[model samples]
Each structure stands twice: as structure tokens, then as C-alpha cells.
Target: MNISGIDLAIIAAYFIAVAVIGVVVARRTRSGDDLFLAGRRLTWGAIGLSLFASNISSSTLVGLTGDAYRVGLAPSAYEWMAGLLLIVGAFTFFPFFLRSRISTIPEFLEKRFDARLRRYFSAITIFLAVVVDTAAGLYAGSLVAQVFIPDLNLSVFIVTLAIVGGLYTAAGGLAAVVYTDVLQAIILIAGTSAIAILTFGQFDFSWSAATQALPDGHLSIVRPADDPVLPWPGLLIGVPILGFYYWIMNQYIVQRVLGARNITEARRGAILAGLLKLTPLFIMMLPGAFAVSLLPGLDSPDKVFPTLIQEFLPVGLTGIVLAGLLSAILSSVDSALNSASTLLVLDFIEPLRGEKLTPRQGRRYGTLATLGFMLVAAVWAPLIQHFPGLFSYIQAMFAYIVSPVVGIFLVGFFWARGNAQGAFLALVSGHGVAALIFALVQSDIIELHFLYVSGLLFALSAVLCVLCSQRFGDAPTDAQTRDLTFSQRDLTPEETPAAWYADPRFQAAAVVALTLLTVIVFR
Candidate 1:
């Protein structure tokens, strides 16, 4: 791929703009709450855009496009399923989360169950956020950077990207992450939309030309139960569970929602994110599908995204797309850095000390922690080359790990009888089941999709949560369940009545309808 001066200018401008935003926001970041939760002043639009941007990381772009090239559109289930699940979260989970005023997702566990669950889940979250999510994003960004600039070293690229993104995150906390994410989201959507249009234009923008040229099932979102990419049953079972954990429970993603000004803003932001989630199927995934004919015989599926940019995009547009890729890398890395540091300071440090830090102290520690995690992730990012593909490397672990966490959270929410002992036992026994299943599958003694494994693990955990709550402990007091449990208030409007069009239920319904329509069209 040849580089042009205009592309360099655009990419340079993006970097400078992000740095300025970080420094400016850092000046306003005065307290712990301001650092971790944006002083609880985020609006719906910022929350929505940040959620989408942080999630659609460089790894996501490369992995989704690559997987679509390798195994039809079945890989898109993870993308679109997020839309539907976000709607579910808007109505079911956001209310409790916002009402509780929890800084981290793990804090909610402590509120609902016990401190042990909080600390344990926080540890797990910190590991996944930094070691897996942040590191992989940096590695993926390096891969994309190398595509355009072949001489770029992996470690050098990783460190440069990390320092650029991390400096702002450490300085401004969640505000910087969200503000930068808003800019990144625009670049990402516009850049990918351009690539999609250019790819489709290759076949005179004919959908049939693109699909018919490929093998059967290439354009289909639904696949047979025996399909290797994503079986239909996994779509129904495993996808939702995974989506629930990522969109609703993950600290990095949920941190933006936690920053929203109010429940209405948070719910509205969730609906906006759901609508945005639908775009990847067309803009990102479909272009990869189109690449099956547009640029065939690639050495690897991972090359699909870069190859498309190299072959199809012109000078100025290439820079914008590359900037978008950079945007993705930074957004995911920064979100993870901020959220992981938040968990360490708020969830672990403060509690262990038996006293809350002053707001100034909190902000200072949070900044140091963000930079510390940033260094750790930068070191680990390049090490991913020793592992399998990025998508599988991340998703396989999540499949086994998230099911137990999701199980405990859902059980604790809906079932008032759920006790701390049951939640603990469920997590312990559930992971034991996961380990056994993982070994059996690895040894070829069993053949089950990871998604199916997720479903099975969830069932066992839920059952254990119920039984142990009954067998070992009494029901929690009404005081313990207050505002934390499921209730009519969760379903009700937070503010006074708004116009019909402004209602969250109405907006959610529209998003849901659009999501279902998308599935039907591609089914």
C-alpha cells in the first residue's frame, strides 16, 4: 500500500485533536467521581457514541471482517445480537445500575450480594479489561498500522498508540475516554461506510452480484446447526449470554452508561448504541463478504480488511479509514485503561484501606493506576502473536468466564431468595464445569461449540445459585434488596412524562423492530 501526504495530515490531525481533548478534560477533572464517572454529567448522545466506539475496537474491525471473509456472515451474530441485548439491558439492568450510583459493575455485585463477590468479580474484570481487551486492541492496531506502513515495528506501534491514548485516559479519566470516543465513533462510522460503498460499487452496487459470486450461505446470517462459524442454536443460546455480559456487565463498556446524567440519559444512550450496532453488519461485515470476490486469494483472512483498503480506497479516504482504525484502537484501549484503573482504586484499594480517599487523593491514585495498567497492557499487547487468532483468543475465554458471572447477576436480580453463599458456590462450581468441558473438548472427547458450552455453564450456575441459596442460607432482608432487585420502578419512567416519541419504550421498540428486520432480510 502506498501512503499519500493527505492521509498523513488527516491522521496527524486526529492525534493532535485527541491529545488536546484529553488535556482540556483533564483540567476539569477534579475529584474521584469526576475522574471515574465524568462527574455524573454525561448526556445520552455521548454515552451512546462512546459505547459504540469503545466496543468497535481495531480487533473488532479486523476480526469481524476477517471472519466474515472466512466463514460467511454468521460471524455477524455477535455484532447485531448486541443491539437486541442492549434493549433488554435498557429496560432490565440500567435502572438498578443508575439508581445504585455504583462506580463500577462489581460495585453492584457488592450491593446485591456481598463484598467478596465484588472483589472477586473486580479482579476478573481487571484481568480481562487490561490483559485481554486492551492488549488485543493495541495488537490489532499495530497490525493495521503495519499494513499501511510495513516498516512499523509491532512493539513500537503498540507503545506509541498506548502512550497517546493512555496519557489522556490517565489525565481525564472517563470524560476523556467518552469525549475522544465521540470523535472516534464519527470517524469509524464514516470511514467504514465509505469502504462499504466503494466495495459494493465494484459490482455496480448489485447485492445479487456480490452474493451470487460467492459460495452459498456466504451472505446468510443464519447457518445450519452443524455450521463451523456459528451454529443456529448458538445464535439462540450462546450469543445472547455473551452479548448480555459484554454490553450489560463489562466494566469498560458500562462505564459510559454509569457516567450518564440520569437513568433517562443512560436508557436513551443504550437505545442509541443498539441502533448503531446494526451498522457493522452492512458497513464492515458485508464489505468483507464483498471482498470474497473483489479481492480473492488473500494469504490470510486477517489480510481481508487491509487488502480492501489497499486495493479499493484512494489517497484521502485511505487516511480517514486508517484514522478510523486508529480511533478504534485508542477507544478500546483507553476505555479499558480507565475502567480497570477505576476498579483497582474504587473497588479494591479504597475497601482494603477501610476508608475512602479524599476526592483529590482518589483522582491522583486513579491517574497513576491508569498509567500503570497502560504500561502493563502495552507490554502484553505484542505477546498476542504467540496465541491463536484475535477473535477466538478473546471470545473463547469470554465464553467460559462470563457465563458464571452473568448467571449470578441475573439470578440475584430476579430471584429475591438468592443469597451470597449461593452466588459464591455457583461461581465456584460453574467454573469447575467450564474447566472440565474445556479439557474434554480440547482432548477431542467432546464436540461442542463454545457458545453451547456457555449455555450449559449458565444453566448449571443458575441452578446452583437457586439450590445453594435455599440450602445454605436464609433469604436476604428487604433492606438488602432495596432498589437493587427487579421491580416495577425499573420499568417505569424516571422523569415526569415525556412526549410519546421521546419515551424510551417507544425508542427501544423501534430499535428492536429494526434489529429483527435486519435478521429477517439476511436470514
Candidate 2:
């Protein structure tokens, strides 16, 4: 666990460089839009990198790797499935979101449903962002710091990481986050690939032996029909709903798309992100499997990646890997900080005060709010010691909250006959069902993975929204009608750019290549 001087120096250099970038960008951001959405001028490459980096947090590296260490490559079902879902998102969800020209996802809820739904979602998003998302980042970062600097107090590490994340996030907003994320993503990928390669070399074992040692079902990409993680039942009903909610509605992820320069760029960015997600198996999951061969019978699965870094990597390379881990942690934390601030200022504060603050006022409020939330998350980070599994805890909290929001958004956009009453009921009742189910599971009244619970809640909410809308019909108030009809029109050819795959030859080749790669890897 002893970190060398070179490793410490490399980590320090990355942090200092990021801080300088944030400070430099802060001076350029003049308005709330500039701060939050980067003046809506981010290119496809920046957006794509940001999306990839933000999603691949330390939780994915540390927690998912841990899961892989224990369960073999089965946990990678989430990462690999994300590639397919991103393609779905690019085609289906991107069109509507880009057309709406909305700043916040909750704003879309206000447009399609009602103000109450918007407010409720905003509140929930803030709570989750601060409690679950930010705290998780802090906890993971502190764990790494503790490993590298054992004598260093946990509280000091937690506070330092939170403040570093908060300062840059508050200063530069999404612009700095996205730009820095590109660099972080590169470091993370390179460092991970290096580790995986080195780990494999050290094993001096064949794939046959590794496969033999793995438990039955570990190598099965397609689980049994009733398997919990990728059950056949879930494919029929669960995955699409979960996909819609995560790719379309989740604020932390979708914020990157919202910052895209145009629909074409947004769609392209999403597709690119989907492609990038497929690499996690090689970088994170495979390394965990390699770890199983190297370091068996570890008490805590979460220690797998850190333990590997300490054992396998050379001195200078160890520092680089540590930097990559820290980058993953900070990238996610900063994104959460920026998005939570946007939701607080745009959705909650302005509405409550009944006064529109100037851009400067908004920026001030956002900075202060970001700092406050960081403090809260720092306090909450240590509490994760009580949780059994990081991935389970993360998923369980989201299952109850994300479904209703997802349902309301889908109904609002696709179902023209949808009404506010249905939206309200669907959101409230969907969460209610999810909560009750969760309580039952906690009390041992039932057995289900949180993903199953999330899928069920999502389906129930969508059905309820459709049924209730049909029953109530349109009771559109003047404001509701005006908002619904306002700026609603099909984009002309001039307005809508060409699709990402408009080139027929390139599109065909990409599809073939991706399909072949997927089949070969899984086979």
C-alpha cells in the first residue's frame, strides 16, 4: 500500500492542472447558460468524451471491478448492454430532446405535464445527486487516497477531495467538466488498459485454465432464461424501460447531451458514447477476472482494483493509475455538482422566489449551492461503510425515484392525448409502488433485484399514465395548452441536419463491424 514519490508527484500534477483549467475557464463564463450549458456550443467530440467519462466513475472501476472479482465477468452485462442502449437512445430519444431546446430535463416535464411534476423531479434529483451520487464519488476517492497514504486520516482525505471537486465544478461548470473529462477519459482508459495487459502477462495462464476456474455461468453472456441480471423476462419488458429512463431522463447523464451544439452533434455524441461503453469489459471487468487468478480469497471485493495496483504496477505506472482513478472520481463528482446546481437554480429557486435572478446572481447562487452540497456529501461519504454492496446501494436508491420521472416524460412526449392529471398520478403512484415493493423486499416479504423492481415500476407508471389520460382526456388549462402548443412544429430539412449515419456505405460498415466485434467478444 506504500505509494512512491513519483506516484504522488503525478497525482499532484493532474490535480493542479485541473484546478488551473477551472480557474481559467471561470473568467470566460459570463452568464448562467455559459456556466451551466457552456453556452450550448460544445462540439460532438467534447460531448461524447464528457458523456463517456462521467458515466465511467470510480464506482464502475472500483465497484464493478469488485463485482467482477467475485462474480467473474457476469457483472459486465450492464456495461456491454449500455452500448446497444446508446444506439437506441441516439435514434429514439435524441430527436425529441434536441427538438425541445430545453435546458433542464425537468423543464421538459413542465412543458408536457405540469409544474408540480417538474418541482417534484427537481427536488428528487437534488437529493439523489447530493446524497447518492456525490457521496459515492467522495467515498471512492477517499478509499483510494487511504490506500496510497495509509497514515492520512479519512476525514482529511474526504474533505480535501470534496473541496477540490466542488471548487472546479462551481467555477467552470459543465464547460470545464466536459473539457477536463476528455483528458481524464484518455488517462483512465490508457491506465486501465495498461493494468489489464500487465495483469494478464503476470498470470502466465491460458484462457482455458482461467475459464475452468471460473464458476459455471460466469462465462455465459446470455444467462439462463430466469437469471436475475439478464433474465429472459427482463429482455421482454425490463430493459427497454430501464434504457429509456437512464439514457433519456437521467439528469446527470443527459446534461451532456443538452450541452451539444445541435441535434446532429447530440445524436453523434450519443452514438459515440455507446461505442466507447463497450470497452469497459476490456479495461475494468477483465482486469477483475485477472485479479481472481492472481489474488484469490480477498475478504472485500471492493479492494480488488486498489490491491491490483499496489501489487502489479511499476512505481511510475502506479502513480499514473492512481491519477486515472482519481480522475474517474473527480469527473463524476464535478458533473453531479454542476447538474445539481443547475436544477436548484433553474427549477427550484426561481420558481419559489417568483423573481428571475440576473445571470450574475444565478452564477453566485450556483457556486454557493455547489459548495453546500459538497459539504453534505463529504459528511455522508463515511456512512457507506455500512452498505454491503456499492453497486446494489446505488441501484436501489435510483429504482424508487427514476421510474416515475421516466414514465411522465415518455407519456408527455409520445402520447399526444396525455394529460397533466395522469402525469401527476403516474409519477406519485409509480414511486409509491416502487417504495412499497422495496419495503417488502427489505422486510423479506419478496426476493427481487433492484433492476427488476425498477423495470416494474417503470412499466406500471407508463400504463397508469396512458390509462388515466384516456379516462380524464384533455383538461388543459390555458397555461398548459399554450405551453404544449408553443413552438411545437416539425423541423424543416434546413433546420434538421443529416443523421450520423447518413452516409450509406459508412453506416453499413459500422453496423457490420460492431456486430462482428460483439459476437466475437461474447463468443
Candidate 3:
């Protein structure tokens, strides 16, 4: 791959601009709340774009395309199901999160259950963030950078990316992250859309031409019960459970929503993100689907995306797409660093000290934690190269961690009878089941899709939550149950929207309708 001077200049300019934005935002970040929650002043547009950017990491740009190349469109179910799930979050969990005014999702757990559950969940989240999210992002980004500069060592690039993302994220916190995400999201969408359009043009702008050479069922989002990629049952059962954990509960994605000004802002931001989620199926996944015809016989499915850029894109245009790819990578890395640090300082250190941290102390401790996680993830990032594929490695780990927590959160939210004792038992016992299932499947004693495993784990956890609460725990007092549990009144807006379209319900309905229309078109 030849690198043009124009392309190098463009990439350099992008880095400088991002650094400047982070520095500007850091000036205002003087406290823990400022660093972790953006002073709770974020609006709908920033929240929405940041959510979209943070989730669509470099691994996603590479993995989504690569998996689509091998497995067809079934891999896209994870991307689009998220839109519907975000709508569910907007109406259900978003209100609880906003009204409660908690900084971290673990803090919400502590309020609903106890400090034990909060710290437990926080420890697991920090581990996943560093080991999975940050490391994977660094690996994917470095992998792509290697494509452009073939001589660059993977380990060096991984460390370089980690340091760059870590420095600003440690400096300014969530404000820097979301603000830069606004820029990154725009670049990512534009660059991917360019590739998608140009790839389709290779088929003479005809859908039939694009599909004519592909395998049967390559365009379908739904698959048979025995399908290897994603079985239909897994689509219904496993996808939602994983999506709920990622969109609604994961501190990495939900922290921006927690930063919103109020419930209305948070709900509207989530709806906006839901709408953005639908675009990836068209702009990101379909490009790879089209590439099945445009550029066939690539040795690695992960090479599908970069190969498209090199083959079809002109030199200057290739630079723009490359920058977007970096944006996607850095966005995820920065969010993971910031969120993990937030968990370390607020959930663990603050609790240990038995007092609240001042803004200056918060910034000092938070910065130290951010840098520590960044180094740890950087060290682990290059090791991911040994995995069979980037996408599966990331998804497989999440399947083990998420189901039990999702089960406990849903049970505790809706059922006040679900006490701390049941919550603890459900988490521990559910993970116990997960470990056993993983071993059985690994030993060839049993066979189950990871998605099906998720569904199974969720059911086991939920039932245990109910049974344990009944047998071992007494009913919670009013103080324990009060606003922590769900109420139908939370769904009703306290004041009317200025216009009907301004209503969160209307926006949520519109996003849902769009998601269904997408399925109908692809199904």
C-alpha cells in the first residue's frame, strides 16, 4: 500500500485536532463528577453520537466486515438488534438511571441491592474493559495501521495508540470523550458510507448484480435453527440478552447517558443512538456483503474491509477512510479507559476510604487509574493476534460475563421482593452455571451456540434470583425499595413536550418502526 503525502497530512491534522479538543475540555474538568460524568451537562446530540462512536470500534469496522464476508449477513443481527434494545432502554432503564442520578451503573446496583453487589459488578466490568474492549480496540487499530505501513511492528503501534488515547482521556475525562466522539462519529459514517457506495457501484449500481454471484441466503438477516453463524432461536433469545447487557447496563456505553442533563435528554439521546445504530447494517455490513462479488478470494476475511479501500478508493479518499477507521478505534479505547478508571476510583477507592472524594482528589486518583489501565490493556492488545479471529474472540468473552448480571438487574428492577441476598446468589450461581457450561461445551460433552448459552444462563439466574429471595431473605424496607424499583409512573412524562415530535415516546416509536422496516427489507 502506497502512502501519499496528502494522506499523511490529513492523518496528522486529525490527530492534532483531537488533541486540541481534549486539552480544551480538560481545562474545565476539575472534579470527579467533571471527569466521570461530564458534570452532568451533556445534551442529546453529543450523547447520541458518543454512544454510537464508542460502540463502533475498530474491531467492529474490521470484524463486522470480516464476519459478513465469511458468514453472510447473519452477523449483522448483533448490530441491528441493538437499535430495538436501545429503545427498550430508553423507556425502561433510562428513567431509573436519570431519576436516581447515579454516576456509575454499579452505583445504581448498590442503591437497588447493596455495596457488595456494586463492588462485585464493578470488578468484573473493569476486567472486561481492560482485557476485552481496550485490548481488542488497540489490536484492531494496529492491525489496520499495519496495512497502511506494512513495516510497522504490531506491538509498537498498539502501545502508541494506547498512550495517545490514554493521555487525553486521562486529561479531560467523559467531556473530552463525548466531544471528540461527535467528530469521530461523523468521520466514521462518512468514510464507511463512501466505501459502501463505491463497492455497490462495482456492481453497476444494481442490487441484482451485487447478489447474482453471492451464495444463497447471503443477503438474509434470519437463518435456520441449525445455521452455524446465528441460529434463528439465538436471534430471538441470545441477541436480546447480550444487547440488553451492552446497551442498557454496560458502564462503557451507558456513561454518556448518565451524563445527560435530565431524563428527557437521556431518553432522547438514547433514541437518537438507536436511529444511528440502524445505519451500520446499511453502511458497514452491506459493503462487506457487496464485496463478496467485487473482491473475491481474499485469504483473510478480516482483510475484506482494507482490501476494499485499497482496490476501489482513490488515494485521497483512502486517507479519509483510514482516519475514520482510526476514529472508530480510538473512540472505543478512550471510552474503555475512562469508564474503567471511573469504576476503580468511585466504586472501590471511595468506598474503601469511607468518604467522598473532592473534585481535585477525584481528578488525581482518576488520572492515575486511567494511565494504569491503559498500560495494562496495551500489554495485552498484541496478544489478541493469536486468536482465531478478532470478532469471535470479543463476543465469546462477553457471553460469559453478561447474562448473569443482566438477569439480576432486570429481576431487581421490576421485583421489589428481589433482595440483596437473592441478587448476590443469582450473580454467583449464574456465573457458576456459565463456567460449567463453558467447560462442558469445551470438552465436547455438550454443544450449544454461545447465544443459546446466554439464554440458558439468563433463565437460570432469574429463577435463582426469585427462589433465593423467597427462601433466604426477608422483604426489603421502604427505604430499600422506594425509588430504586420500577414504577409505572416513571414512564409518564412529568411535563408535556413542547411539540408532539419532541416527546420521547414518539421518538422511540419512530426508531422501532425503522428497525422493523430494516428487518422486513433484509429478511
Candidate 4:
């Protein structure tokens, strides 16, 4: 846990360089478009890397390793299934998103349904992304910060994370977020990949040897139907539903895809993001699996990652990895801050004002919202330390909020018979189901796994949507329905790139195949 002067210097320099990038990009900000969607000019590569960076937060890096150490690889389904989900999004959701020419995902709801729906969706997104997800990131980062500097105050780390992430995000907006996220992605991958390699070396360079001390089913991707953590039914049903909500619809993630230059760029960007997702199974998850041998019997699974970095990695190398960990923190924090601001300004503020603000006014309101939300998240973050397990606590809350929304989003998009009344009831009933199940399960009155519980909630919501739509409401107006339904016309242009390898369809299909093959191999 002791930090060398070299490590201290490396970490300090990383922060300064990121701040400089924020300042430089702020000078280019001339409109709301530039702030929120990167002026809709990002290329596939930047978009892909930014998505990866924003998503692979400190919580994921630490929590995945920790979860694997304690409970085997059951939780990895959430990570791996996302690639398949992104493929689905690329083909289905992103087409609608791009064609709508909207800045926020909730705007799509407003266009298809009504402003009330938009505000409702946006409000939920802000609470989850800003309050829950952002606070979790801060808690995880501060947890790691304490490991690095035993003397560091938890509050200090939390506030520092907020100031660094919030200031840059508010100053330079999405363009700065994406560009810095790209840098964070590179550092994070390189640094973690090194640790993964070194971890295998601890077992004489043999995967078999590294996994020898693990629990049964520790390396398996598919668990039994009655598995305690991740039942096979849940893996099949719940994961995809949650994955769709996250990879396709979650504002924190989909915002990057929404910023791509065109349909071609967005599709390619999404595919590229899916490809990067595969790396975590090895770089993040396996390290903890191996740690069951290398660093055995740790007091808490959450401590496994830091223990590995502290013990095995040399000084300069540890510095790079530490920076990568902080990058993860900043990446998620800045992303959540920016997206939450967008939702507040575009969905609620502008609508309530009864007229659109000029670009300058929009930027000002967005900055204020970002700063305010950062304070709230920072204040609440350290409380997450009280949870039983970091990873499960985060995932469990998402199930309550995200599943119902996913049910409504998918139904609203695909089933023209679906109505606003149905959507409202489905959304409301979904959370009720989640709360009821959580209480029952926590009281030891139910044997259902959490993921299965999420699946149950999703199914209930979907059925409620159908029943209510059929009985309670009329069809969407022609104006709202136009170009809202899915069709062949939504695809990217048929013109082939000079190289077949460049085709989004080709790249995306390859990512999907690899994902399926991985699941089968691990199963």
C-alpha cells in the first residue's frame, strides 16, 4: 500500500495532462451540440474507445475481480452478455436513435410517445446514472485510494474525484470526455493486461495450474438451473434483458453511440465496443480467479485486486496500473456527470422553460447541473462501503430500476399496439415487483436467484404492457408513429467500404460469433 515517489509523480502528471485536455477542448465549445454530442462528429474509433472507458469504471475493475475471488465466475455473465447486447443494439436501437437525430435517448420517447414520458425516463436515468452509478464509482475509487495511501481521507478522495471529473466534464463537455476516455481506455487496457499476464506467470504460465485451487464451477460460464448466484434460467432470460437496457438504452452508454458521425459510424462504433468487451473476461475476471491461488484467503474479495497490484507489480509498473485504476474512476464519473446533465437540461429544464434556450444558455445550465449532481453523488458515495458485496449491491439496484424500463423500451419500439397507458403501468408495476421480490428473498422466504428475480420482473412488465395496451388505449398518432417502427429502411447504406473488414455488419457478426464461442467454451 505504500506509494513510491515515482508513483506519486506519475499519478499527479496524469491528472494535469487530463486537465489540460479539458481546457483546450473548452475553447472549441461554441454550441450545445458541441457540449452534449461532440458536435455529432466523432469517428467510430473514438466512440468505441470512449464507450469502453466510460463503462469499465473502478467498480467493474475491482468488483469483477473481487466477485470472482469469492463466488467464482457467476457474475461474468453480465459482462460478457453485453457484447451480444451491443450487436442487438447496433442492428435495432441505434438505427432508430440516429435517424431521429436526437441528442438524448429520452428525446426518442418524447418523439414516439409524449413529453411526459420523456421527462419520466430522463428523471429515472438521472437518479440511476447520477446518484447510484456515479456514487458507486466514487466509492470504489476512494476505496482504492485508501489502499494506495493509508493516510488519505475517504472524503478527500471522493471530492477529488468529483472535482477532477466534474470540472473537465462541465468545461469541455462530451468532446473532452470522449477524447480523454480514449486515452483512459488505452492506459487501462495496457495496464490491466500486464497484471493479467503477470498473474498467470504466478502459476508457472499454465491456465490449468492457475485455476487448480479454485472452487468447482469457478471457471464455468454456465451454471446449474438451481445455482445460488446465477441460475441458468436467469443467465438466459435476465442477462439479455439487463444487457439490452445497459448496452442499448442506458444513457451513459448509448450517449457515445448517439454522437457518432452517421449511421455507418454508429454501427461500426458499437461493434468495436463489443469487441473490446471480450478482453475483460481475461484481463479483469481471470486475475481474480487466478488470485484464488496467488493471493488466497483474503479477508474480502474486494481486496483481491489491490493485493495483487501491491504484491506482484514492481514500482514503476504499479504506478502505471494505479493510473489506469484512477482513469477508470474518472472515466465513469465524467461520463455519468455529462449524461446526467444532458438529461436534466434537455429533458426537464428546456421543456419546463416553455422555449428552447440558446446554445450559450444551455451550456450554462448544463454546467450548473453537472456541478450540483457531482456534490450530491460525492456526498452519498462513501455509504456504499456498508453493502455486503460491492458488485452485487450495484447490480441488484439496477435490476429494480432498469428492468422495467427495458421492458417498456423494447415493447414500445417493436409493438405498435403498445400504448402510453400500458407503458406507464408496466413501468410502475415493474418496480413494485422488484421491491416485493427483494423483500421476500432477503427475508429467506424465497429461493429465487437475483438475476432470475430480474427476469421475473421483466416478464411481468412485458405482460402488463400488452394487457394494458390492448384494453386501455388507442394507437399512436400517425405523426408519432412515422419512422418510429422498425424496418429494413433503418440499416446503414449498402455501399461496401473499400475493405470488407471495414463493414460494420462484418465486424459486428464476428464479435457476436466470438462471444457465442466464448460462452460455449466456458460452459
Local accuracy of candidate 3 as per-residue lDDT tens digits, 300-340: 88899899899998877787899898899899999999999
| Worst lDDT 10-window in candidate 4 | 487-496
Candidate 2: lDDT of 509?
Answer: 41
lDDT of 3 at 102: 87
lDDT of 4 by residue, 170-234 (tens): 99889999999998999899889989988888888986788777888898988888787788888
lDDT of 1 by residue, 344-421 (tens): 999989998899999999999998999999999999998899886777789778999889999999999998889999
Q: Which candidate is the best by lDDT?
A: 1
After superposing candidate 2 on the true structure, give the runs of residues whose Cα lies further than 4 Å from its correct spot. 203-206, 209-212, 226-230, 473-520
lDDT of each: 0.91, 0.78, 0.91, 0.86
Q: Which whole-number lDDT from 0 to 100 does residue 480 have in model 4?
A: 65
Q: Sort the candidates on lDDT, descending order.
A: 1, 3, 4, 2
Query: Which pairs of residues have clashing backbones in candidate 2?
Result: none
- Which 10-residue span in candidate 3 carries the lowest summed lDDT? 387-396
Candidate 1 clashing pairs, residues 3+ apart or interchain: none
**Per-residue lDDT value at 470 in model 4:** 86
Off by over 4 Å in 3: none
TM-score of 1: 0.98
Model 4 misplaced regions, further than 4 Å: 492-494
- The better candidate by TM-score, 2 or 3, is 3
Q: How does each model score on TM-score?
A: 0.98, 0.92, 0.98, 0.97
Residue 9 of model 2 has an lDDT of 97
